[model samples]
Target: MSAIDNLPPLREVIATHQLSARKSLGQNFLLDLNLTAKIARQAGDLAACDVLEIGPGPGGLTRGLLSEGARKVVAIEKDTRCIAALQDIAAAYPGRLQIINGDALEIDPLQHLTPPVRIAANLPYNVGTELLVRWLTPPDWPPFWQSLTLMFQREVAERIVAQPGGKAYGRLAILAQWRCEARIAMSLPPEAFTPPPKVSSAVVHLTALPEPRYPADAATLSRVVAAAFNQRRKMLRASLKGMAPDIEDRLIAAGIKPTDRAEQISLEGFCALARELRRP
Candidate 1:
């Protein structure tokens, strides 16, 4: 039996179901219940929250969330072999567990969840960054979820929390930090997973701000940041030339030096530049 629940241990369940991790699906089964519970605890109190979990391979983390007393957990899994495996968990928890068998990239998890939502997952490596960007750039402010507790490669985690002027700071750093409070909650070694990934992993916790920290249109800010970072080595005036006719004047108007590279620009600086681009 698993330490956290009466359900079978993950290894035995995997053996019985012949559920081997597939590289193409970015599957890395986390078999340690102790570690999984620790990950769940990092999400804060789940007692009153409904969680959206992505890529719940063999339901290891799924069990962890449930054990922590989450009101409900909606898990999206792409692997068919794991559906029956997760059914075992669902039965153990009664109505608290809901399993959706489909691609996480295609499915909109919000439709299945209600208010007071928190997304907690050990995400598939390949789609982790894309998913984060999608969540960060939602059409509306004060997004559906109260917080995000997601696991990503250590490098990606560093990028998410990186400050201005650092090598890791770029588009992601601006997008994540401009409107949210993000931090690396914990780090895990490669050996933690059944099929160890070459790179280590870390969990990031991001809570959305009631309003953006600075004033700027999201679309314009994205374009400006993209342009600046796309040619990061170039000075702002040259890199943003395609974005505005009087790019140097706009840079000066924003109180930014024309010779500054993208890495040197703070989030507020980027917002100021984006605002200048929007002016008639």
Candidate 2:
């Protein structure tokens, strides 16, 4: 039995099932139950929340979520090889663990879960940022999940929580901080995973705000942010010239200098600019 639960240890389960992490799938199995539990705890008060987990290889973190009293855990895994192993975990918890064999990118998690939902996962490295951006930019405000506790490469994690004027800060920082409260919950070394990744990883926790911290049309804001940062070093006048015929006038009206670079603009500043561009 595993130290934390009645289920077998992750290593034993992997060996028994002959489950090997696949580079193509961006899999790096977390074999340490202690660390998994720590990641679970970072989600905060899972007893009342339904959690959506992506890429639960060998169910290590799945077990942690179950043991910590999550109301329900709906795990999405693309690898069919891991299903039977996850089934063992479902049997152990009975009615609490729901395993879905599918690609996370293609699946809509909200369709399967109720409100007061929280997403916690050691996300697949390849699609991690794409997933986060999807969650952040959903058409609707106050997204389905109450919060997100996700793991990412340390570099990616830094970008998620990065502030303006920092080297890591850019489009990601603006998007993440504009709509949610994002922070790095904890850091893990390269050695933390079963097959140590070349770079370290970190857990980022983001709580959704009731409304965007500043108001601007979501699509407009996204386009404006994307355009500005697409040429990070260019003055806004040069980069955003295609966005509007009178882009310089819009920048002036928004109380922004057309000569300013993307990295120098704050979230609210960007919102102001987007609002100006959005005007008829």
Lowest lDDT block of 10, candidate 1: 1-10
Q: How many backbone collisions does model 1 have?
A: 0
> Which stretches of model 1 miss by more than 4 angstroms?
none
Candidate 2 lDDT over residue span 1-280, tens digit each: 6678988889999999999999999999999998899899999999988999999989999999989999999999999999999999999898999999999999987778977899999999999999999999888888899999999999999999888887898888988999899999999998989789999999999999999999888888889999999998899999999999999999999989999998888899999998998898
Root-mean-square deviation (CA) per prediction: 0.8, 0.9
Against the unseen true structure, what C-alpha lDDT does each candidate score? 0.93, 0.93
Q: How does each model score on TM-score? A: 0.98, 0.98
* Cand. 1 TM to true fold: 0.98
lDDT of 1 by residue, 15-99 (tens): 9999999999988889999889989998999999999999998998999999999999999999999999999999999999999
Q: Which residue pairs clash in candidate 1?
A: none
Superposition TM-score, candidate 2 onto the true structure = 0.98
Q: Tell me the spans in candidate 2 whose CA falls farther than 4 Å from its real position.
A: none
